[model samples]
Target: MDNIGKRIKHIRKINNMIQTEFAGLIGIGQGTLSEIEQGKLKPSIDTLYELSKHFQIDLNWLVMGAFECMNLKEYEYELLRKTRELDLDCQNEVAEFIEFK
Candidate 1:
């Protein structure tokens, strides 16, 4: 489990996504993702890029286990996603509330 594949699998698990869903989001087949997770194959650069971009994964940590996999937990990511959908004024209010708390 000390490889890129394992790390990617970890990301998927923490996000509560199954292989089919995770692979679909990354534009890869389930079989390919399975092989990668099993450490029988390495992920391509494009896949790596997608993983980092879509899941907010840290590339350095994904490739080298150099740091934390993600700076935010799943709940925090969900909160941020929801915040981004709010109107600007509401967003500001939410930020202010969080800061005050």
Candidate 2:
């Protein structure tokens, strides 16, 4: 998607809501909704929060077209993957120690 408008449109279609219904749900006029989807208008942060909550969408995905993956550097993902292999009790202990530190 080129911008937030396209992402919003994609989400609306995927949720099976037309402009009128989606606008009603989001508490905006259909004309305004159309303008937003057409890129003539940008949605405010409050509108974005409403959309995210109503649709169970990740806000990062809505605003940016992709989930903000874990901000961890390369080694972190590998470390976490290995950490998951530990027994549950051990994992909890490790987690507790990490928090304590």
Q: What Cα-based lDDT does every candidate model obtain? A: 0.84, 0.76
lDDT of 2 by residue, 55-87 (tens): 666676577655325455435533564576688
- Judged by TM-score, which candidate is best? 1
- For residues 1-101, could you state the per-residue lDDT of candidate 1 as single tens digits? 36899989988987799999999999999999999999999999999999988876667767876643555554665576568668899999998999999
Candidate 1 minimal-lDDT segment of 10 residues: 66-75
Q: Which runs of model 1 end up more than 4 angstroms from their true locations?
A: 68-101
Q: Give the TM-score of candidate 2.
A: 0.63
Report the error of model 1 at residue 97, Å: 12
Candidate topping lDDT: 1
TM-score for each of the candidates = 0.67, 0.63
User: Number of backbone collisions per candidate, in order?
Assistant: 0, 0
Off by over 4 Å in 2: 68-101
Error of 1 at 46 (Å): 0.3
